[model samples]
Target: MHELSIVMSIIDIAETHARNASSSAIEEVELDIGELSGVEMASFDFAWQQATKQTLLEGARRQVNRIPGKAVCLDCSASFPIRQLYDPCPVCGNHLLDIVSGKELRVRSLIVV
Candidate 1:
């Protein structure tokens, strides 16, 4: 699954940073996986459990912030919260929207030691 690859990438990044800082282990990791980011948290958690074995991120504290989806309607300039990518604007009922957030998938921070 793609989640496995994603977890591997995260481990790689964390390890690289740790090594760059002259550290051998990561203590914590913070991530922002938005609602519209298309990552399945269940699958990601499972992959993380398997992928972090013997790695720098093993036993690292992981904090995930679930960001809510938000968009601005192009037709009426109304901003609204969305649950899905195809959600139409509630105020103007317009399909055209400029997504302001909730598409993020990134490692926000890492604590290495």
Candidate 2:
């Protein structure tokens, strides 16, 4: 799964930063995963468990902040929450939209020790 690759990338990023900062271990890691980021939570968790072994993040406390999808209808200028990218606007039932958030997939912060 691609989630495994994502976890590996996260580990690589944390290790690189921790090493650059002269830290021996990572104490905590915070991630912002949006609803429309296309990552399944169960799969991501499983991948994390398998990928972190013997790595710098093995003992790190991970905190994931799930962000909900939100968008604005372009045709009706209505704001609403969206669960999918193609979700029509609730007010106008229009397909055109401007995504406001929920496309994020990034590491927010890390506590290195």
Model-by-model lDDT, in order? 0.92, 0.92
What is the C-alpha lDDT profile of model 1 across 81-107, one tens digit per residue?
Answer: 999888999987889999999998899
Q: Model 1, stretches more than 4 Å misplaced?
A: none
Best of the candidates, TM-score: 1
Kindly give the number of clashing pairs for every candidate.
Answer: 0, 0
RMSD of candidate 2 to the true fold?
0.8
Question: Model 2: per-residue lDDT, tens digit, 7-109?
Answer: 9989989999899999999999999999998899999999999899999899789999999999988899999999988899998799999998898999998
Clash pairs detected, candidate 2: none
